[model samples]
Target: MTDHSYEFTRAITRRPGQSITRGLRAVDTGAPDLDLMLAHHADYVATLREAGATVTELPPLEDFPDALFVEDTALCLPEGAVLMRPGAPSRLGEVAHMAPVLRDLYADVRVIEGPGFIEGGDILTTGREVLVGRSARTDAAGVAELATILKDWGRPLREVATPPGVLHFKTDCSLLDGETVLSTERLAASGCFEGYRVILTADGEEAAANAIRFNRFVLMAAGFPATAERLRRAGYEVREIGNSECAKLDGGMSCLSLRL
Candidate 1:
């Protein structure tokens, strides 16, 4: 039997560095507080460990300000790991750094080798298929390259569009389980999740959409009580983590790690 997409036995995360305050963001709320981010990151790693994942905590990469958002560099799957070619010029080099790390963990690691760019943040794997959303950072050529790679692995790839202005596809949604997704109404309205069960974030808590269902726990950003309660009422064991600092740079629970 295939492992469910969320059933991860391990995860890879990087510690926040002093350069994290310079992480990219669509809207600069303000510079992130590095001390606060580090404390919160510790809690995030702890939560993942608590959920039974053997977390690989990589050292901080000060050269890449957004290096801590490791999810954008690669896609981790049961079959192998695929390195992404980020659309963001500054983030392109981040993939090279992650390649060796993934190589150390997987026997079959592939690279996008793209003339087009894709980011791991724009890809979401479900029990049935792999969905790739074309955003400002993930283009058509990139999706096509990814589709070709996944095809070789016997995984079907579906092309979709990220909501306009959203940094990444997952910025507006996340897989809750094999067939269910937690999403913002705006993205859900796009009909991208046609066959899946969808749960919309609370009217004023759209930020809560980017969550991760890791093992037995659904980790979400703290402070979205309505969304958290909605998840709980749906029978998910939810854990909230401080996201204030990361939020300033448009990072969230799902952005912090690569699980496999």
Candidate 2:
């Protein structure tokens, strides 16, 4: 039988380093508050634990400022894990640092090699199909490599060109459920989600588009009351968590953990 997709029962997260304030961001949202980010990180881990997932916490990488965004380092699959080669050259070390950890937990761990750049945030699997985005962070080479790796899984693949304005495909959209997507208007109009049910976030709540559907509840970014209400109306048990600190560093709920 085919394994259930997005069925993550364990999660791995990292503590924030003092230099986390120097993390990468498209815009100068200003430096993030290390304390607030740490506090928020604790809450994030708590949420995962509350959902019955065993949480593995990694120490802060004092050298990698963006190491807190652990998901970029790898993509956890039912069969194994794909250690990524981050788009930013500076972030490549993250994969190296995470590989050993993954090898300890998974027997079939693989990686994307040179000349191909891929970040976990650019790939979205909805249990039905895999939607890979061609963005600044994930090129055709990267997508092709991923397709090759996923061939054994036998899922339909769609290579969608990410909207120009977004940092990553998921920066503008997220898989809310097997067939439901929460996306920004620009990404929603890209027609990449034509067959799925799309729920657009409220005006100015674009960042709210990035969310994670954990074992039970949906962990959404705080400050988007309208979007939160819309999700609640849809019958999803939504949990709002403050994201202001992570936002300054260009992170969302999805980027904070490697769910497996």
Candidate 3:
């Protein structure tokens, strides 16, 4: 089966700081570094366009300075967009703000209303199946509900555990293609991401493992010398953009934006 063609969009927030998650509160939130982080995010978006994708920038959501919210929380599907009820209570408002923006782009927009919480980052799709990771941010009930919503659309859903200490499944892992995945040694060793061809990275290079593959270009951080070389050697045209500022906030290439 052929994968559905999609485009990605992101809101560039004036507040380009690192995220403070429920688990990790010690994250650095230095102020001066934000400009550099915003620049890197712009570069990443530009790289996507260069790779033949149509990227549109949404107006900056300045009210929410930590606006480069994880792309997964703002779940987007081919038929429409699903505004997630962020697992984190503080982030719930983000979905309400994102709904109108997505509605303008898509003919249909929906919501995963909560008695249960779900984040977009926990959801990943391969055109045929939707994989939902049961993480700190996504509940099992959310997954089951999502599965039911997608059933008639021909998108089967699979649930997997994101495991502890990992931000999200896609934060530590991403599918480069139907058969090829880029992941950190931590996730690969867990034996949870088994059954696929996995490319593991070296220690501390796990941040670079979370990348976005749009068209033929791979969006990754600017500084990972060895890992970038490895991807190039594997025949992918890699785009290394600086996202150090976002990194400081626990954000990576895949977290900052959502592709429709």
Lowest lDDT sum, 10 consecutive residues, model 2, at 1-10
For every candidate structure, what is the RMSD over all alpha carbons to the true structure, in angstroms? 0.8, 1.4, 3.2
After superposing candidate 2, which stretches have Cα over 4 Å from the reference?
1-3
Tens digit of per-residue lDDT, candidate 1, span 84-127: 99998989999989999999999999999989999988989999
Per-residue alpha-carbon lDDT of candidate 2 for residues 152-257, written as tens digits (9 for 90 to 100): 6676678998888687888888877788999999998878898899999999999999998886779989999999999999888899998899998779999999
> TM-scores, in order shown?
0.98, 0.96, 0.87
Which runs in model 1 stand beyond 4 Å of their true positions? none
Residue 138 local lDDT, model 1: 96
- CA shift of 75, model 3, Å: 2.0
How do the candidates rank by TM-score, highest first?
A: 1, 2, 3
- Whole-model alpha-carbon lDDT for candidate 1: 0.93
TM-score of 1: 0.98
Which pairs of residues clash in candidate 2, taking residues 3 or more apart in a chain or in different chains?
none
